[model samples]
Target chain A: MDAASAAIVAKPASVDGLLDLASRDMAGVDALIRDRMQSEVPVIPALAEHLIGGSAKRLRPLLTIAAARLAGAKDDACLRLAASVEFIHTATLLHDDVVDSSELRRGKVAAHLIWGAPASVLVGDFLFARSFELMVEAGSMQALEILARASRVIAEGEVMQLTRSHDLNLPQDLYLEIIGAKTAELFAAAAEAGAVSAGATPEQQKNLRRFGKNLGLAFQLVDDALDYSGEAGTLGKNAGDDFREGKATLPLLLAIARTGPSEKAFWDRAVARREQEEGDFEKARRLIAETGAETATLELAARYADDAKAALAAFSSSNSWRPAMEELADFAVQRKM
Target chain B: MDAASAAIVAKPASVDGLLDLASRDMAGVDALIRDRMQSEVPVIPALAEHLIGGSAKRLRPLLTIAAARLAGAKDDACLRLAASVEFIHTATLLHDDVVDSSELRRGKVAAHLIWGAPASVLVGDFLFARSFELMVEAGSMQALEILARASRVIAEGEVMQLTRSHDLNLPQDLYLEIIGAKTAELFAAAAEAGAVSAGATPEQQKNLRRFGKNLGLAFQLVDDALDYSGEAGTLGKNAGDDFREGKATLPLLLAIARTGPSEKAFWDRAVARREQEEGDFEKARRLIAETGAETATLELAARYADDAKAALAAFSSSNSWRPAMEELADFAVQRKM
Candidate 1:
């Protein structure tokens, strides 16, 4: 990490503030998640619980709760919307693991590996459908519209990534667009939907959505960087998984650009042909560090983090939720996981 | 086929009456489907069109339009809902083909085969989300609830079938439950939602739902029977697919029970172990035929068809749609496909 990034990290930025603030609402959301996921089909709940139970952060739903509370929510309808957001997130993760043939997720064996891809796929559908059911019960057409569009956009992003993410010459803007759609869009929708549930003004909804989008971008940028720099134990997924799969994530792409011709043969061998060998990941990581690619990625993430905090400036400083949310932006970039 | 079943088949029941009645509405539905299925992602539209363009009979949406018109709909809202129903059905077919790993759908190579399973799965999600967006456009939370619940039930049924469809000793009621959820719930919801769109009375909505449910049951029963007795060319799918997959559809189950000890070794090897030789499907077909299992299945289908027609008695005979829908019920069981 760069000196500035390292210094910020040394201070131990944390989501504890946001978590504490949203704890009670999140408890309700968790209960709703558990209650709705149950089915007489047995495997539906079993497979959903296998992944959802492993999820420690529940970050997206927390975003919903925090945004709602920040917008002065008076009722518990946001609780249902929060649970709906988590279901959408969980459904995407389930389908993503199946699509990627992923081995691990959230520090546990992937649900597809346990329940089989067919079950995982079907359960994902069930959760997606259930999310809509919850949204309907929440009785906000606006929130439902936001989430439905987000779900479609996320699927499009996944398809785009599947077909384009492996290209060596893929443009950086395209990659950003893919992540913005796939990852940041959900974050934006979660926050916006929560704000809508609380009857926030359009201006407030726009600002909260901006906050979430930037926060999500920062989160994904840091996650991509961590794939090259962090450990599997803390990451909850194998650190070198993206590298082994030859995914053209930001760090690797940046490193290839910075190193120029010096790493041409290495990139070709490791990424193009995917003829990876022992220590290849270590070599790639070393090159990323040596070329300052990891630092650059972290710097970009910090920029987004700053943008995320700035978006919350419209809220009153006296509201504790405001600072808690700003701290969440920093935590997005600073967390090792 | 039994004498009565053969006589019914000789009469050549057709969907032409319903097709003529809903021809204009169906054209609107077809156009809406084309418009909504398009995406900026190239492969999405291509893959969706590959399956959708090959669909000669858009039956579910037809039910929606027919039901709405029968219930005195004057607005075009039901057209959008009809398109939404088709999207839901197409999405399920895409996922179902992937889960079953079938090579044919609607007489064309399955979308998963052409675009790969990941694309198929994501596109299925895209269409599903798009279905909800369309429902939102239709401006009816009631319709959205019905479709959303139907979607969840369908996924649960898919998982249930994935886990239980292969059991040699599967019960008749359990088998009916699986198909009912997987295939018939959408039909019932489609009709009910259409009736809702027209502000139908509760009794009218109930009758339409019954019409749809019974018709869907007959359709699936005939489809199951066709897997054993019909020609692949006429069926638009491999005739022995269920047998090959060791799926205990009613025909195979009934044949196993009625054949008793005589075919014990055959069922044990062919179905229980899925150890089929070159002519095993042919042998299974002959056994199913000789034991009158196909006739019994068709007889049950006929009963459902009769019930479906009876449900429409509440509608005025002067209204052309009532007869068209009744004919549709017969078409469901009597069509070769």
Candidate 2:
């Protein structure tokens, strides 16, 4: 656990290489996920099936399984930990949909839209409590505390975002804190718990945490950028969602900073009122591009990805896990998703 | 610890004696709760305060603290566990308000109606995750596991209630299972965790679990009856809430059993449609009274309360905790709340 403060990662590494390296373990995590997600109450399994069964997010679980690989683990606690991480992610998505009033998720209708907000909220809770049970079964109090704290931080972040919505003057640091807590906290905890489950040295655990945190930051940055990219095409999610929801993402913030009075009025009317005139989305996209906001977003994402890879410097480069994770960091920024 | 499986509570005991017995410990639990519920996210605490701060039951925490007393705990883990139990209960209440579209709670406007459903739902998540942190901090894996499992069961029970909604012919035992899981599970877990934190023997923990479970069942049965009690006047919660919500509570279910064709048709319209005409509640009240539904409901509650008291017999009649708890069981059905 001593690596708690390390912050270094390498050049862009292949995301596919990362997945291929742990394909077998990834399969196990999925199987465990499918089994654990079932419930005797039919609505439970039906609803859970719709949400979890829809996504193929092998990323968070892959990070967990890969972290264990780096730690030379022979036990399967990593599998349970990985599944728990996915469950946490899925649970948050359910609740997030309810909070954001999102109509779509992963290109499919949001669970809340189909099942109603009540089911989505309660089922999310069911998944969360079930996640804790898995944490306990993994037999690591440290892991449990880390994940539990992360979960709390995630909720706080969501609340922060909610409270900060549509405020064009939203500070950069506060925005970062919101995303860090809302997204990166889970990523960081997943990597840390994987290390803990594998009995990694404190230093190694700290390194993994840093790696996960930076990678997560890079990924979220890309997501925010993609929201304005128009052709984002990630998870089949439509772009301009942040705008429509009156969320003050980085693109809008960056572009707004450089806009004239007329443009500023444009953003204020479009975002503040959450009222998009026809072609407003297209005009917003053009403004964001003219300001080079997407490039800036991607540039920062790349830097964070580098930090994520560099965090693994203490590990042997000869160790496939390190290089694979570095590539995964690269994918965090480069992929459409 | 010898109280495990012991069955020998006397006649229904006085509920106030139990509350009086734990008065000092309840104060400590309340203090801990106030400290823990605060959050840097002002809305987190603001929304939370509106829900938990407005009214006080202090009953759930009381059971936890009192159970620890039964096992002679010397440490403060019981206080943390008690606080955690209360947080979980409060979180559920927040979510329940959103689910039921409840306009009021604790005789006041529901948080959802004031803060909005998004804030209420997200804050509920924050409280739940914070609760797990508390469980971990209590330093008893046994307590953590028991509470986590209980939390999951509560979610399942809620989902069951939702799925079973509008089914006038819902099975009696199935209804029991629903209430048992939704309400009794947490109470049982709280008492069991208390014993575990006290380092009680497995036998003692089992006994306490049984005691808490039966007491919870009694408590819930009374709540179901009180929904039709007309002047429940406890906690300032509105009566006919269940009837209006079309929830198939015990009184409604029992009363329906005695109704003829016309009465059955009336119930079918009111409950299934969840659309109450003027004077419908009055008619429903009359029917329940004529059928002795309230009496039957109280009788069942008393039976469970007796079971709750009997579960504490092994603690020795001389032990004041046992007597108080026995009396507490009696209070389950007797209280206006």
Candidate 3:
């Protein structure tokens, strides 16, 4: 092993120590990403550099690297695998913006807004193709199978969302299914790939995958809850963006189910018209609180977070991944955005 | 083999001769496609059935079936492979219409115009994912590799087209490169997969793939040439559409190289403005014909057709596939639209 790999193998004694480890390991993958993203098309490099260079928590890749380190495998291949997850995530964002016709992402104009829809769509396709090529280089059919299945699940979830749009009767189970396929699948795959690459035993890989899956579900539940409850400034956008779009997210679903006849008309109009007047946002917010949907949503998020923490019980007390996994569960529900 | 496999093997021989083989084999695949395309989303089934039910000639899938038959391999696998090609081709068309913001395709409003852009984009992704699932069931990694590579090439060609848009300096070589990747790669893969499924020798499979590749190239060149010369009513769109879009196709590239100073200025303005007045279109058409660019483009298409025909020489003269291959070559140039 090289100097970087040797240092990465050493145990991090604290949260700051883990962050330092993550930062150093991610630097190599980040550089590799920067190198491959260059294109003669002026718009490509500009959009890629901006979106990729922009501040991202890097949680997904960090989970991948941390999981591999916990499994006692530290190698350059793990770094490449970690980078592959980031590329896949970034590619999905580009396509998602185009499909949603989204204007703002991460508080900035979307790639489609600046580069036009065609360029953004095609560049997203390029990133997806490049990601497959990168995974192919990893020489693991198992990893390819995991990533491919995750991609298909993500696409299907997006389709399900499209199909469910504005339908106030969307069952909570269906909503959970959509979130699991779209968000948790990728998280699970990332952690599973890390463990598999590190040659973890089958049972350990399953536990790690379950941990990531629960964590992802919790993360998305919190995201949906925050759409109704988060501060607009802190979230970098207005609260109720999903409600404005007529998305039948968790809070709205729960609220509609719990509302009385008097509030049903208001909910119907809000969902059908997908528009809120000056005071309508406040009324809707009050209704959600009164119906106890806010509490239910947060409670559900907490339940998933607890499940995530419990999955770590499969690992021994001496394993360094335990604390990081616990912190990730906290990060899922506790983040401001 | 089962009864269906036996029927597939025996039916092609009863289809009169090699030339009629394509149409006969296409009927079964077309019926299978229509049956399989049923969906819970009303818009999905409506749009997919309408598009796939149109006059596509089923050339790609026919190439696959013909190549397999030529290789002396007969099974149910060919039907699955043929349907897989059509599914992928249809999916790409759905996505391409959105990317191009195209109003009309096959003489009708595109799916996006009918159901809106988000629906079209998401449904397109659904079909793409579905194609993978279908291919996976075929259970051949070699087939998977071919289809995956073709998809990557198609996306790369699309990116190249997006990058080269409105750039008058695009060279003929680059134009060929783009078309080869965008158009020919899928056709080649379709044929190659047929041979692969049928367990053909490597050399025979390569020859069939080459044949499909050249034929696809020739077909695209002819289509591009007709965009400048064919009647608007016959071709289902206005002549000079590529020129209006500032697309650097073969005829325009040749015209620019051969025209005089005054004609060159006209070319520059017409291409730069993209949408030209009647007078501009007339002058541009006159200059292109006067410089023999039309004839030169025809010659190029014919040469590719010949190349396609020659690729079939590897098969014995007595083989049924040889004449069907020749007919495909001829049909590549003979089409009015």
Candidate 4:
């Protein structure tokens, strides 16, 4: 069997194992998130509650907490950093829903849809500001620098996505660059900041960041593949959202990379022109599956998952936290969303 | 003459003189703003250029730079703080234009109007992150805390304004509180951060912040009045915009405060229902003039200006920069916009 079949047959890692491993730290993070989300202005808390009170996992904050624990942190500064990292992630999601004109987020109505765009935008700013305040309270300049730089890179990636939205193919290198900045940068930073909070060695910090970056890439790839995988509950939002919005995702990009002028024209007319007829999404999904883009994307994701696990190999085998982190990477590839 | 009459006749201080006083430091800030605005993502810089390349006064940075010099700053850190202060101001302006659905900003078309709201918002986020990076680079925890808290307050104030937009009779205290957070907090933070960068005594920091807070109040009052004052160049955007948007301004609030059955009906129709006729702005302006509300507003602004000036009196009667700061406060009230 090929590597793709090997990946497809592989048993997924247990996410519950990692979560249980970091259960205490996760509880602290959740408490911090709840406390910091409150504001004197009633609407701030109202909007925050609406956005955060959902079934969606606080994965980014979990990573921060887990990374800190894995690196042997002593104090509660990682709790603050974990909360801050999640705030940034949540803030970005709020703004992104507005930008994408998304109708649903985390299996619920988008905050921007309920509140006006203006209020949503301001509340996102509030959360971003609060995140920085947490970093300041943490009193780590290194953590502050990493997260702040990640935020700038995230915004840059968003703009690049917007600008490149004009072109359909979007090029492989640019797609990687965009996803690296948009998704992986924050993941990398969250892990690095956690390591920094623990006062980890430079090499340890670099290893943790590498683990996170590869894990993030795998997570995004799996998510992108899931859009066309014809699986319900795999996407937080409606399936074919990427198709309807003409957003270039990995599966679609891989499908576009295949040879066929007719196939190219079909995508150009459907996605580039946004002139989708009835059954177009069905056709697009079928075409993607026919080309085995979903399988290919998932295979690539599994590769990254392996890379993430390898990055953590330098950590002592005796350190039980390292195994959980490796399992977390596998879970990133295996998760439906 | 009545007290209002005396205020109308008062000779305010020179703004150009204050700008001149801080010209050398202002150059450093301008250079920093230009350099920091650049991003690897082309659209980031492109959107920033459209927003920042205009008729912006950047008064916030001027106060920061001037206050630092007055407080005896020894290094170029104040220049970084000044630039960061201005970036925060610029970021809010970008988001404000989108929130207000503004057609113009800084005497040019709004960035949202040009780049679309999504791009405008993301770029605003980018600039805001860049501002935090600057604060972190300044390496003053005090400065970071001040600016971060101010940014959060600014967002809260914006949400408060949105919540209160339904009520024409938004109470005076709430109005003060809203504007204090939305406008004055940043000004206060700017001053405080400058003093922090300078490593000034706590007393000096308090005085500078007091000066900035009052000056911001005075500045906002004048701007609120200018919407009805019927001037062209005074406003960066179109005149009567506040009236059209039905946004609560000091002139409108003062006009509503006057007790008359017919007055209440008129405002209810114009602001609450937003059912103004073609000549309604003319009538609103005439009514404001007739009630001495604009004059009253200006008088109140002038009083804040006096308080702002008084805050600096303890610094030194002989500090060359002190008189310039006093002039800047006076200019905040006397300026057309």
Say which candidate scores most in lDDT.
Answer: 1
Candidate ordering by TM-score (highest first) = 1, 4, 2, 3
TM-scores vs. true structure, each candidate: 0.98, 0.95, 0.83, 0.97
Cand 1, B chain, TM: 0.97
lDDT of 4 at B103: 85
Each prediction's number of clashing residue pairs: 0, 19, 0, 0
Better of 1 and 3 by TM-score: 1
Instruction: Give the Å error, residue B47, model 2.
Output: 1.4
**Weakest lDDT window of 10 consecutive positions for candidate 2 chain A:** A1-10
lDDT of 2 by residue, A1-337 (tens): 1111122234333478877888888888888888877888888888888877855666888888888889888899998889999989989999999998888787788888888999999999999988988888888899999899999999999999999977998887888889999999999999999999999999999999999999889889988988888463455567878988879877788888878576877887889886688999888889889988877877888888889988899999898888788768877776765
**DockQ of prediction 3:** 0.32
* Candidate 1 C-alpha lDDT tens digits along A1-337: 5644674857877889888888899889999999999999999888888888855689999999999999999999999999999999999999998998889899999889998899989999999999999999999999999999999999999999989867888888998998898999999999999999999999999999999999889899989999999888888888988899898888999889988998899999999789999999999999999988998888888888889889999999999999999889888888888
- Worst 10-residue stretch by lDDT in candidate 1 chain B? B1-10
Please give the range of 10 consecutive residues that has the lowest summed lDDT in model 3 chain B: B7-16
Writing each residue's lDDT as its tens digit, candidate 3 over A162-187 gives 77868888888989998997788888
Q: What global local distance difference test value does model 4 have?
A: 0.86
Model 1 chain A lDDT-worst window of ten: A1-10
| The candidate that achieves the highest TM-score relative to the unseen native structure | 1
Q: After superposition, how far is residue A286 of candidate 3 from its true place, in Å?
A: 5.3
- For residues B127-224, what per-residue lDDT tens digits would candidate 1 score against the true structure? 99999999999999999999999999999999999999779899999999999999999999999999999989999999999999998899999999
TM-score, chain B only, every model? 0.97, 0.94, 0.90, 0.96
Give candidate 1's error at residue A145 in angstroms.
0.5
RMSD (CA, Å), candidate 4 to true, equals 1.7
